[model samples]
Target: MRLKYYIIAIMALALTACSDFLEPDSISTFDTNYVFSNVDDARKGVNAIYVQFGVDGFRSRLSNNMTGNTDIERQSGWTSSGDRYQIWDLNALSSNGDLRQFWNAAYTAIRDANIAIEGIEASAALNSSDVLISKTMYHLLGEAYTLRAYWYSMLTYHFGDVPNVRLAPKAGNDFFLGKEDRNVILSQVIEDMMSIEEKMLWAEELPYGIEQVNREFTLGLIARIALQRGGYYLTPALNMERTSDYQTYYQIAKEYTEKLINLKDRPLPEDFRQVFLNNAKFVTPVNDDILFEVPFAIGNGDVGWNIGVTVQGGATASHNYGSGNNYMAIPPSYYYSFDTLDTRRDVTCAYYIVNTDFQEEFVNGGISNISQGKWSRYYLDAGPGASSAKGTGINWPMLRYADVLLMHAEAENELNGPTAAALESMARVRRRAFDSALWDEKVDNYLASISTSKEDFFDAIVNERAWEFGGEMIRKYELIRWGIYSEKMAETVQTLKDMADSAFEGTGPYADLPDYIYWKRNESGRFTVLNPNRKIAAAPDDTWTRESWLLGLRNEVTIYQEWITKDWRNYIDQGPKPGVARYIFPIPEEAVTNSQGVLANDGYGF
Candidate 1:
């Protein structure tokens, strides 16, 4: 069962609110002594940090809407000039409201965490003679540290080198600050997580389970941020580079992932689909596939609303489930890239929508707009009413055990050239992707092929991540760190063109792929399709309905949709530096105005 700790506890911290982005009159005076004097109040102080996750900044924008234009997940933002479109198109201005919302929310959460951390450290309860009180206090302190690190990690990656505000707000404190190096911020947070993770309890020991941050998640985060610190990043000079001591960070990743695997290990859940179904079903089991997920209440989060399968209905519609649509669509290339027998393919990519009639129907444009199939309100046990669209209450998965295993494999390979340990780690994740019957061919042999060289293994990891975590919205950051964001986007564009040419001309590498698909509901009323992998001369029966598939990629005037061809042009050729993604966004106008000459939007052509 999930707890209402965060929601119920945050109200007490309202009077002690800190200004977003540390403006003057930053911290309103509050009685910190009373709040941290006992274990219960201290827990409330920490819970306030999680309140930000339920806000619009993370619930919709940062989590799903703004993270797009990747090889797998995409949105054609070329036509619209809205705030979200500006972000999707990678040309967000300083005044873009979406960026400002996330920026402000992250800093607000950071400020709350800072207050809790300081209060907990100074609290007399921390050193209480009673074992229970002392242990609980220590755990609360760790929670504060981990939460603060999480916010810093998001801020640095999204805006690049944001001001490092480490102290709790006070009247005399210096609020105005300038950007620090992103590496410095990442390094600091990584160290912060590392310091407290060992002292924190595991998920099973905690009442909230995977719904809240625990030792395992913090340990995994250490490796994750370490890899990010070690990986390539865009510099002020518009160059893609990593620090000379990058290997040190990689070693940190290797050590921490290794530590987690050794001290506390869990097998990847065999049924990948059930992993997400559990989230929608509100069944969060401890020591399972997920390490930590942001626990949004029933009236919060945009999981199924904006990031899952398209559900078309409204207040006046026949169905009571209301409406939801995927802001980011799966590229047909990504859909076809999956192995035909892979179970993850169907679960990760959906070509149908829950229509207004509450019946499954093929998406209007077919291959042009394949929605994410992982989760949807249609899968909910009960509807939230026909007028509902914004919140589905499905928890957003922050980290999974599969990611930990993959990170272990990647870090091991980078440090020691695809060692036996590395191959085993990769194989563990792949083993779950396929069935036991095909393990020898799909898992063992595939691992053997990729283990030929370090480069081959690394490439396999990249492809594996795309297939494993499609629709999860972490692909953009992964590509950036891999220094292949532009290369992959360019490749995706060309692949789309090839797919279009083959379907239009009926003679190319993808000619075997069907131009149109024949689909029908099965006896169980589940949507099924024929010729998903290759072309067929005709449908086997009249029961099947035909729809344009690959053929939909082109029209009379263009080989592919103009949006497809122009989708990543700026990311590939016209960014701040050619062939490099301009990962940094301009500091929000409000933040710049509040900085009092300490900050400006200057680098990366801002």
Candidate 2:
């Protein structure tokens, strides 16, 4: 019940990565007096949206929460028993100035979008420009709407529900703007995407980047939104009682996912690793597979912090800091998903790390092993001292062909519980983990080599996601969607902690061995123990409770945010009896005060 509702979407926002956006004017001060009269100015407005996305991304730039990354690392005092995995801290609700800046920037861009729309309309009315200019006006107007909707969607995902302020004034506090219903917000987003869908073109054929919102990306967003809304409305993951709206969402998800599956924009890369780079702006110009993603310029672009050192580093790794070290690592049992012959294992990660410097030598989750290859060294070259690092790659996929296929499998599995088609989708991802040659021999050529049942198809999907996406944080969404991540994560973490504890004391501290470690008092070495760095297993700790520890922090907004003050007990059933709340999230407390009249969702924390 103490779990905060704010959860950063790790798998969210797939456009250009680590970019920046700002204009001469600020969102806090808006002006309709100055309107858009030319295509150039209108183009600037659309570009402004991408910049806003960059700023928004900066808020989550550090990590698995707001900065969603797949490489798991331990935070401060993570191994200890006292609230080691502090979930609230990882959530998007941070007091950090960067977060505030990004939030302000998002609104600033939103304000600009509003200004653009108003300005273009007024300009057209006054007959400001010629025929070409008039056509430009309409195009820019539609573009503004698309950008506005996209920004709102991003905000909604991170904060859950927010005030629907469509207009930004030239002056004064727009916080006075009343909150819009979540349903209204979603409806607006859908309308905007659909409107732009007709106006936008495929990036491949498009001449301009700003006006070039890919139709497929918009559709993907539509699909994602439907799923989220559906899950929120119906799934027991949040323990919601409502099921009335489930079927609608299920249908929407099914329809959109199917649409993406058939897209000819691009096919899956022959090399799975190539898929990412190929989509990057620097690599292939634009792979058809990527629907849309935040674009990061090279050199000056925001190369994310050295995630390997930050996420995989241990107690002594200099790159990792007090709060953002790696406690999370790959569970060996999970490794079975990757066939030993799979070349991706080595390419995705370096099984070993050589941190001679004691400071950064062992901070990588204390496991001493790392999955280093998942991210290219280009990202690492960008950061030296600072905890924040954004890589130079302009290419970040927000939506892609592979994800579409997976979604189809997931929606299908969720609706039907599981199916062969879903299993095939899952297998295709896994088979690619091996080298193309090995894959051809073992999987493609041999039909029966990889076969699974309905019940285990999801598990296979999870494995494929983990192995393929690895450090990208895509797996986290899968865990949440399935509603069992907390328990599984707790089990995994406790097992590692126990093994390390036993190894540390039994031997005189881990002997700095890689792989597996065991303690032994050598005959010639007196009482000194021989400690190998092999991964060890410990009995599950009953005390490690997922109910309390599983992802305490999230980018999701708490319904509690709506209430001025609340009786804590109303949200949870936990005391000695530990009763759970019917519905946990309250509208953001700010919304309750900001709305025209006080409004609260039913059964929220009550």
Candidate 3:
């Protein structure tokens, strides 16, 4: 029951391709009456909504490449002028191709979901006397609602107040529409998901399990979007603001997350690395750590191609694990921020890559180029081919159970000031991060120290999320909702500067940190490093190879690399509004032109 195979089989028959942002090509020729007459075709109609995820818009760009310059994940886009680099630099123009692709894909998916919802609601199969037929139709209806809501959630945040298209395309329907208020769009989707989530089936009950949108994912998404609605966002005037009744949304977030915890809770996986390794190995089990993932079929995803540890391979290479490069690198400051005893540190950051000779070697770039160590094509059980690069068939995780626990903790702390319920939820997530022998100090004592005040607990949650989900590309949205997007980026710039200064002058905050690291392969033929956390005078023996660590932050004539100094310059101080990141980008020029007189590029100096 692999969902991707079904989706691929039905895409051409059920989905309509869009000619522009909102105009679907030959949609009027689609026969919805026959498609939604039964459970089988209705399921195919719903599966079409997921086709957008496999395209260039999401497969390579939106998932990982476009979500950089955050506090944890980074890429110095100052030296490049490509479409993705422009986005990473936080100055994307109206003609940016990446934005155009994602914008069109989102609207196209929304249109497909709209068709499914309309057709499924009108079908008589929903009220059929056969219980299995009736129940299955209801689940398909819920999937339509949840999938449409997911696209809207991403749209409103990326491009504020996008056109809200809720109806299926028709010959006489009004295609030209104005931008709807984002708050209104979010509220509508939140209500839409809430009304249908309970009627949906759980993952285990569904044929595709976690590959399809189930009740657990819907419930978790309600909480996730409620937090986004209650949290801060940039306005057209370029000021961060939240609704006056923000606590109501927080309450919604709290209740929905608690409902999932009480009804369908599963223990977090004891091993942190296995959560992502499961994705690489194509081992998807329902009701486990991951709630839902985009099920990309063979030769259709960009997981290892653009977002994992670099693997150098080609026709001349010995191994067949094809070349892959991480567009988003882990920041050195983020690597240093982790506790030495924490098990997640080594799994989240890697300084070595698979060389062309099929051997592990240090990355050529300095400290700034450390690859995200979560998933790589090298981790695949079998390589695609020697010259393969683009598609690894790996699924992209959308939500996890750890996020639900943290969301519950955050909401309860905000409303009730770190009560016992809040403390317990936080502790549950922390316990799995450490061994039982060390839980007394790492979990128990750590919770006690952060529970003194509400604000303290919130800060702890922020830091805990950074450590727990470092390599994942969701930090940009989290920082934006917390109203610290620019603040954190500025802090990262200063931290890098301080590390560079300390390495050169030999007396500062990071002076005790290592200026050089020594490494050698162990008996198991694995790369091993010494003095990764502290300074050392010399290697233990000549068997070790030494490389400059923090000292690489500076070069011959400059205090730091030019790209490092200019990494987040506009996002910090030179954006549309100084000291504020203009998170909203303009709608693509083609979209605006196609809107007739209904849309305009008007706010944040667009």
Candidate 4:
């Protein structure tokens, strides 16, 4: 039987609208006056908030490749001519549809929660049925609030200054304060969510893992937001500019997340692949470790069929059993980093693939042979019996219980710098990945990955995030929060190339670097276009800023231009240069056109 499921991405906050002046307030159309007469309406509203999870996951997954977040350097090839889909520019994104959907959905969710809040305040005591429904109200409302906070935090990280909206703005609501300070926005988000934290239970719903928000999720979210606000507004790695609010967030993160970690069910399962493959033994299931996760369903909405990079006999309607790469290729060094015994290396990327071109065996390229491999299954259809319309049932984890364990470990290490407990926590993940029996004895030996000094320990945690959580949204956050993404990209990409070149010195696989000629471009003005070549000794450490001279040849430049700007400083509270607007996602083109710009929060542009 085919099970149709949907992963509700409720916990989204909007693009902090760039400014308050971008849109005008709508009067008399929608009001909190007659908001909720029943519970289902409120539940649906809560569902809307969850939609942000979808937005976050899809955007994170696609961009992980194109964003230089991962070592998958062939992203430009995936977007080139004759390809299935072309990424024209950085701002023009594969996940834009989700962005558009998310903006509308999040606001609608806010409007619904606003209605519930208004109703709760206005009504009297309820019967038993009403009591359960009331608790649901607070739970969902709290979730909505948390999602709002999460979304806003994400915006502030990506863009910079975003318009902040608290209560739903009706004709009579306070519209005077349109553009609040980023800290002020963070404050409102935290306050609204924290208000309901005490009222909800910290339990995970069944089937879904720990990353799903519960009371524990509230605490974790608090920790995440607090840490981010601390880094961005104050206590930034370089101490660029410190917000008076830094201490507040730092303490909040310490307290709430510590409570979560100290819970009897704290710590993650030692296995690495099970976090993604086995939903039953989920880290959250083992204890309160799983804080929050987005839901996934097949043949549903935007996140439905044929959406990922898996090709050929892949689960999509257009498959002829010969199209698609089966799974996206990975860089060779990525696999080399894995110990032969480490389950994650195989679980994360496929080393090789098999195909028969003329009833004869043909081995073209595999993930290990390439740069980075796609980890998910690429069944052309479901059960090997159904058509492309039905795909293998696999749910991708946007956030997992393991991630929470790491987050707790990271937050703890950040505060104290170096502590055995923190180091032990980090090693627990790696030990399980390699050998569980040796966990207690051999785990202590991993200091080589990071080092022993306090400062070095902190650096180890950052590297741990990269080495352990590579390709996930966490890497970028780790780098930026640690104040090192620009440097790390330049360093790692180059390291990869040099490392590859060194390893393939005598190996036939990389002589003349047949896999790398196309990376080079000739911008010798006389011919301003690329002259294709594939003779690579190793993958080059090419990135956006590094490819300034060959902007047309690289996708890094394509994507970088979409988001990074001379305006990043403007979004910073006290930043000198202009910063990207951080708060709310720009109201999508349809949104402005639909409402004549009267309903948008502000600070949005194409």
Candidate 5:
């Protein structure tokens, strides 16, 4: 409850990713006059709002929280405990430490944004100096409002109806405000973003290599917010779904996503892996496909330390990334779910990697074998010896044009089944996943395979999203919105159990052993781990035999076999039933205690 509501946002304007501005936090009295005295001051004020995106508690934790509890990823290894464990394990209490960090961090960002909004508004009359200055101030103010909307949207999504503080808190003001309806808050956020859509510049209009909050990304935010607002959400107190909102938001989501699709030059990249590689390598010549990314710099603030080596694994014969904790991996079922011909299968999840001996080796001594290669730390110049290796300048893509296309397809399927435009939009994503010549044919065959019904098409969209965005921290939310999180999760575990029940014998990693590993480079230029146990007819040419360890356990239970025998739902905390309230987290105990009865765990009153 000791929320330090101050002018910290304004005081830290000079601490940008690149140090070009001045620091005034040392000054006893913050001269408000100089803070907004010119266009540069206004620009600094707005840039401060974006600083939250790189903070330890905000975007970094957000990515982990969103992805950790899903079907595709699990928290294991050295770094998987404490608050994050509470989130994935599901025994999170109102007193959970991370819940407090997330709540406090979000409100801190929101409070600073309110200050920026007020300052920008006060400087409107002073913009009579230059034409460019006037335009800049307006643009800056627009960003402030859009950002505030974004933070509030996040709060409402994670924790139901939170206090809607539109204005900055003043000394001696009543801070114990009551919770407001999440829908009402989202409505205001949408209106605020709409008000400034035209005033802001697009990513393309900005200087090359500069990542900023622009018009298209803001519109994407709008589409995302509207979709949530219109979709089913647990109500406060009862934790029941708002059944009536789905249709309304579906239309809103479709409108905004379609607008994005129609935008000039906002095309999906031909290669999916290339887009990620560009970000990891820090592509000098920036591409337009990445609508928005959180910028980071070594020695300054960065996300690579948290996401790169931590999320992905260490150096292997297949790739190099110095050292990494293989803390998270996809299940065997998810690995086998992908079509053998699909390019995304190998890139999204790699079960086996070639060792130093140029032989396929299980990752992490086979504890948690699979690894995500989306953001490889080795892609950065920082090596194991570099002190800054942990702080590589790899940015996180919050919104990409590929997501825009998929959203459009999902909304269209919901509204009017599979239309031609929707099919083409979805096919564009598949084209990147497969070879060019057969891409269209694969899309046609996939569409034809699904039943010609809206529900069936939505099912396709659900699976497509999993393949398209494996480790991007999006699937859990998608499952919740569709009201199938529990059902689909049960199926996921069942898939694993079925594989274990059959033992390792049929295909993939379970096939019968012949000793030597079999692998091939897919069209995507990534290594695909084929069946490692395959035996072929050869005359004195082949001499590779199974390792002693593998031969010893020929028909015995393996790590994967042991994994399926335990309770898969152990990922959910010990208690807390899989109810609507369980989908979102509980508000921190201190906040509720300090709210003076103003903030109750209405939806999640467990």
Candidate 6:
């Protein structure tokens, strides 16, 4: 049952030396009969697949880059050069270092999964003498297939059509097969998952619970995959295509999401913040709504330490796990975009208070001071500055009930316009983000204001998703599928430009703050707000100078001034045009060259 401990050594049994790097070699000499001979070893084989979740490029790097550079989150100005910057700048090349890491990690996982599936299936055949395969054996095989499907899902999502390896590759095997179409890979993956849905254990039944993949996670993934395939994707041919029958995929997504939603005791959590705070506090999810998560341990991999306070700057050793590198941040415009009433805004953003550490004072160092707090170390069990660098023991949820509700609303609206069922689902998630006492009336009023048209309702879903899953890494993929990644980023650029020019005077959140003034904490220990009218104040000392003190400790200015002066504009279009190639990443250069003409780096040749 303690499978995590065994993940470290599981890969040793399957690897072998080979000439072609792309041609994965699983040692034919290793005895599959022994590895999957019993339930315990079979479980370990599955454990190996989960181990890859904690690997560098697989979870940390991918999640960081995918979620880090949208309109909501921006790359820090400090780390200006690197693969992370390439991803944020939307100009990722085939040679980007982390892109190569992501490529190698995903295919390696796929190769391991193929080996596990072959080993488990062969072991099951050898046990045919038994009247039926043991329940443990069935679950083991079910998990193996699900894991394989999950890895393939990642491959298709990022790299478009990739080599589909369903079987273990031995010494003389041709692992250098040409890439398969994405739809082709997704079909195989969907079929493989559907076949095992009934045999796997549900989240409610698992002894280890959310630490491992459960039936709900499998079902959620089915919906996610179907919805993705059902939606538009950029292909290597440099054209967008609905690779699958979209209506069928949408229906599949709808059915699975609704089924997951109506499960006997599962429902949306009463509060939105608890979804993450629970993970930060317990490091293990006990919430009913969390269907599946990637588990972490004290020493296994650097999953938690690499996110949150470690990267979000402004973290002092006093308030977080050591000092932050200021590597990732949210733009001031993004921070201002939120409605002041939404509880999620505060939890997601950390507004900069004035700093007077040196002879001169500053306001959030201008725009560079804003950062995210969703994964802050302040929420971890060890609290800020947990003595070790290994990683905080926090399990990251891959799927949540709120997402199902949102997806359900989206698909239902697409299928039959705006129905009461779809509207209600959207309301439920929105209501949770506000004050509970006022939510009922406020949410109803807000819903009534939205046009009943399908397009209007769909736009509501788009905005809600950005607010709901801001730092969770779901937004980038959503924008790409909606076919507006380029337009949205362009719009955000203009919006920031306007805000910067006006010194944020009339902006909803930043309106009342002065263009420049002093700030200091009051008796209640909260920072006092400066008057917007101070520019022409009767008091002569109320001037917009760095030396002026107006009832506070340090001079302050609206964040917009900083946005215009900083290098914020460069985040949007640092490379080529926003075309089909921009939506999908280029296959790593090493991967293509090493494949010896078997692999084509078509759309990503740049």
**Candidate 1's residue-wise lDDT over 1-606, tens digit each?**
775544584565553443556562333445788888899888888888888888888889988888888999988878799999888888999999998899888888888888889898899999999888988888888888888888887787778888999988777788998899989999998888887887788999998989888889988899989989999988878888989998899889889888989998888888999999998999998888899998878888898888888888886678988889888999999999999999999999999898888888888667878999998999899989898987778898998888988998998999899999999988988888898999999999999999999999999999999999999999998998899999999999999999999988999989999998999988877788987999888898899999988888998887578878777888899777779888788888899988888889987878
Q: Regarding TM-score, does 1 or 5 come out ahead?
A: 1
The sequence of per-residue lDDT tens digits that candidate 5 reaches over residues 332-372 is 56766777678887667754443333333445433245567
Model 4 lDDT on a 0 to 1 scale: 0.44
lDDT of 6 by residue, 1-606 (tens): 222632456654555322233756545666877877777677766676666676667556775554455677666432466777666655667888887877776776666677677887778643555534465566667777777787777777778888877767666677677888888888788888888777777755666777777777788888888877788777655556685478888888888778767763355777667778877675444446677777766454344455553333233323334323234566656666667788888777654331222111233444455556576544565543424444555667677777888888988988888788788888888887888777766688777666469889888888888888777777767776777665666666666655444443345433343344444444654444343234334333543233121122122564334333333343335434433325567788888888888877776434
Q: TM per model?
A: 0.98, 0.64, 0.98, 0.67, 0.83, 0.84
lDDT of 4 at 366: 21
Q: After superposition, how far is residue 591 of candidate 5 from its true place, in Å?
A: 2.6
Tens-digit lDDT track for model 4 on 1-606? 111223332122221222222243332343333333345554543454444334433423332332333332323322333212222122333234544544444454345445445554443321225676667556655666776677676656543454465665445655433334567777777777678887665564323334334677777777777777776432212233447567677667767756766763455655565555442111235352234544434432221132232333433434343322322334444544555566565455533232222111112432223322223333323223223333233343444455555666666666676566666667766766666665544456665445456677776666455556543435545555555534444443444444444334534433332332222223431111121123323344451111111121123444322112211112332222213212223434554455444444333332
Off by over 4 Å in 3: 5-7, 11-14, 28-30
- 95 Cα displacement, candidate 4 (Å): 14
Q: Cα miss at 62, model 6 (Å)?
A: 1.0
> Tens digits of per-residue lDDT for model 2 on 348-434?
543333232312222233233343344432233332333323433334445665666666676677677556665565556556666
Worst 10 residues of 3 by lDDT: 5-14
- lDDT for 151 in candidate 4 is 65
Compared with the true structure, all predictions reach lDDT values of: 0.87, 0.44, 0.88, 0.44, 0.62, 0.64
RMSD of each: 1.3, 11.5, 1.3, 10.5, 6.3, 5.4
3 against 4, candidate with superior TM-score: 3
Q: Can you list the residue pairs that collide in candidate 1?
A: none
Off by over 4 Å in 2: 1-35, 56-99, 116-154, 168-175, 178-184, 208-212, 233-243, 276-281, 298-301, 306-337, 350-372, 376-395, 415-428, 436-455, 494-606
What TM-score does structure 5 among the candidates reach? 0.83
| Model 6 misplaced stretches (Cα beyond 4 Å) | 1-21, 76-79, 125-133, 300-304, 310-320, 352-366, 383-390, 504-575, 578-581
Q: Summing lDDT over every window of 10 consecutive residues in candidate 5, give the lowest-scoring window.
A: 18-27
